[model samples]
Target chain A: MKGMTIIVKTITRWVKLFIFLFGIYVTLTGHLSPGGGFAGGVILACSFILLTLAYGKEYALSRLSLKTAKSLDSIGALIFLLTALIGMWVTNVFFDNVLQKLFPGTDFMLYSSGFIPLYNIGICLKVGAPLFVTFIVMAAMRIRINDKGEREIIQEEEEE
Target chain B: MFITEIYLLVLLVFMIIAAIIAVEIKSLISSVISLGAVGVGMSISFLFLAAPDLAIVQIAVEVLLLIFLIRATLGREIVSEKGAVTIPLRLLSIFIVLVILGFGIIAFRNLPEFGKPVFSLVPEAPSNSYIQHGLKETGSANIITAVILDYRGYDTLGEATVLFTSLLGALVILRAKTKKNGTKVINHKETKARGGE
Candidate 1:
């Protein structure tokens, strides 16, 4: 696919960075704000989706390849699991806030929440990468109508 | 009636109209757009209901859904077939919907009014303690975040696992299984060659 017109491309180039930053901000500040990991992850995915919509699938895939996305997805889940296991090892309780015991930071600060922000980051990666992959996979199967009015399938080149 | 209530009512009416339009529209693109309108209206309603987190998620997910639906429907010819539902079936479905709506309204009437906590404030409730001690325990200013990530961390972990599993399942189903000899099992090249002309 060639992608949309120049207007969309230009606007996407300008706006996509801010959207990515906002997603990061949301993930980082999940403990202090309304949006947590899930929401932030979705927003991050949207930025990539926006890029795909504007610059075509090839460019988007170049930015974040299937191999990298799959790895990030697994790494995210692993991180979350490791954090929980570490908490259990430290405090003998699953998912306990072990950092809270050591530091016990004050409320409303950026780093006050023990492991919540870490969880947020993990969930964000877990969600964002898979969602982008899903979109890419779904978008690969292209169906178009020919002049004879017959439904035809245009298959994307398979990635190795 | 409060101004917010009026806004909510208006949004609800708009959502209903959009939903009906989505159902009745013949064009797939138009139907998907109308459905997206309904979703946007719903997210707005969530904001009016003071759930910013839900509103954010709803709007983002709605946008993604719209994109996927539109992509699927774009350039596809709708093979017009006979209506699956007869008049009697339509009437029966309408009657069932009305009954459900009536029961829902009755239940709503029995429940506590807006902006009032009924059962959540009870001493035995987990949310009650979370609300009371969330900041002190988790040191997170946002109680919802604290409750979700700290108090209910196990649930969050389970939810993450569920997402991972679903993603894995989708990938597994969609992926083409290839033979070891580098020959394609799901032959897309043949379809592409046929469609190329």
Candidate 2:
């Protein structure tokens, strides 16, 4: 689990925040831009993966624990479902654009897209957190045998 | 547009070269990098085709793919520098290529000219409507986004559910512990140190 060279670590530290911000921007402005939820979420996950690659799992996990990722994953799914349910309650449609009425904001503006951005945000969280957690869980595997002649899996060490 | 065509032709050439390297290269890391180059070339081609959304998504997906692949190959010895291609395997690949080429030749001759659609025969394509009224109806500047989030929302929901299910499945599989000897005990010190509860 030990990280790469110091050069990579320094470069990652410098660029991780910018990558995160770019992912957020892509997710939020999805309606106005090319990148939507899935693309932006993948970028978001890449940023976290980059940090983990540069600084090792232990360092990155300290910042974002597996517990936090699991909760965020569920929260994202719940929010997405809730948004759709609200659509059903109001319009009797499963996934209708509920904001087609009252405040049909102007096109081309950032705030114009009603539920699109909300859905994008929800999807970004759902996609990104789980993806990162999958990487962490997969990478953390350390198999060993104990005194009772039983094979068990444990987390790998931080150091090389 | 003529110059754009030339650029596209060059990009396509590079993409082919990248694809070949991605397959033929001995070093797994080099192969992955070459595959990413193919992705970049495809993204550029998407840009030339006026599909910025596809270009962005393609690039982001390429990055993620590269990361996961590199991670997967970190300690693996799957790729061998000395591994030689067998004659039968090579013959099979050549046969497949010839078949594809034959199909492409027939298809190209039968199909209409580029930039001309046969969609006029079918019912009004949703894409035409999306381009015409996507922004006005959805208030989203990006028609692709509008279509994905508003018009074809059910498909997107299904896709999201698929991703969610895959993640959930991975979680379950990763967390599954084999109950060995009725008392499975991994290194207690490491478990107490930083294991996810």
Candidate 3:
């Protein structure tokens, strides 16, 4: 039984790693491909779900706490909004690409597109964190009724 | 006019069916699913009307809203018994559907040609050329990104603000308030009874 548990844990770890990497790939290639922040975020959230399923909620929460995830989500959202507001400062319109003055040339370079990549990253973080939080919180809230008809909230005890 | 009329008719039919399903479904989950379907159908209609931006926004918003709704509704006891669909209810739904469909068809008649490129009143600067150049220059292949972040960055920012507002709303709604007041506040008598058992 112990050996089986170890094997299961190993497999779950690999699955979570694969999902996380796939999410990165999707977000990076978003500009050149069909996928974008929405798809990438969903993929990233799926990795957390995999971790939660394989190792249990406690294990998952240990790695990525709900509080930390919520903070990251808020920060990402703020970054995205700030990027747009900065555009107004530069060009009198919100989100106008005034950063082109900082970059010399334009034509298929990473820095050439101004703040688009940054925007993508912001959206990726924003979408990924909330999605993971939604799944984890809901799963953690599950109540199990035992054979004795006693209801038990199946989660770790709150830490001091 | 011809193709537009045909497509409009098809969309009208879809809208009617979606409404009926949404109204008649016994299960709350199924009704929510139908509501999502209705949103998707409307987004498609928006796309048909040459509002790609609106369509994309509509689809994204609908998807997020559906996720939130599903999470909110999970584990709740669904009222299993559905009362009979009465005559007045049926007639009222039908009447509402007809009125909306008629209004939609009338609106469709006033729309511009589906394929015609309407000119913007703004200065005809090098927006198109800049977009073309962006494809080769930005190392990004997405035309939408080129237009959104490069040519029209301000609009993208507004879109981001909309997303931020939604995230804030979700946080407010889902935030855990007080800590679990010590695990169901066990009653002493009940605890003793259980101990005796």
Off by over 4 Å in 3: A1-8, A101-106, A143-160, B1-139, B147-197
Query: Regarding DockQ, does 2 or 3 come out ahead?
Result: 2
For all the models shown, what interface RMSD does each have?
4.6, 3.0, 6.4
For residues B12-54, could you state the per-residue lDDT of candidate 2 as single tens digits? Answer: 9999999998999899989989999999999999999998988
**Model 1, position A15: C-alpha lDDT score:** 98
**Each candidate's chain A: what TM-score?**
0.89, 0.89, 0.79
Candidate 1 lDDT tens digits, A13-104: 99999999999999999999899889999999999999999999889988998889989999999989999898899889999889977888
lDDT of 1 by residue, B113-187 (tens): 788788564669667778788888888898988888888888888888888898888777556653343333334
Candidate 3 C-alpha lDDT tens digits along B104-177: 99998877678843433224646656655766554457776666556665565565566657656754543333
The top-ranked prediction according to DockQ is: 2
- Candidate 2 on A1-160: residue-level lDDT in tens? 3799989988998999999999999999999989988888989999999988888888888888888888888888887888878889998998777775548887788788788898899899988998899899788755566666766777543331
lDDT of 3 by residue, A1-160 (tens): 2123777789876777887998987776666666766678789888887777777777788888888888878887787778877877877876655565466445444455566777777778888888787776566544545566665444434332
What C-alpha lDDT values do all the predictions have? 0.86, 0.83, 0.70
Off by over 4 Å in 2: A142-151, A156-160, B1-100, B116-123, B180-185, B188-197
Which regions in candidate 1 have their CA more than 4 angstroms from the true location?
A142-155, A158-160, B1-106, B178-197
Better-scoring candidate (lDDT), 1 or 2: 1
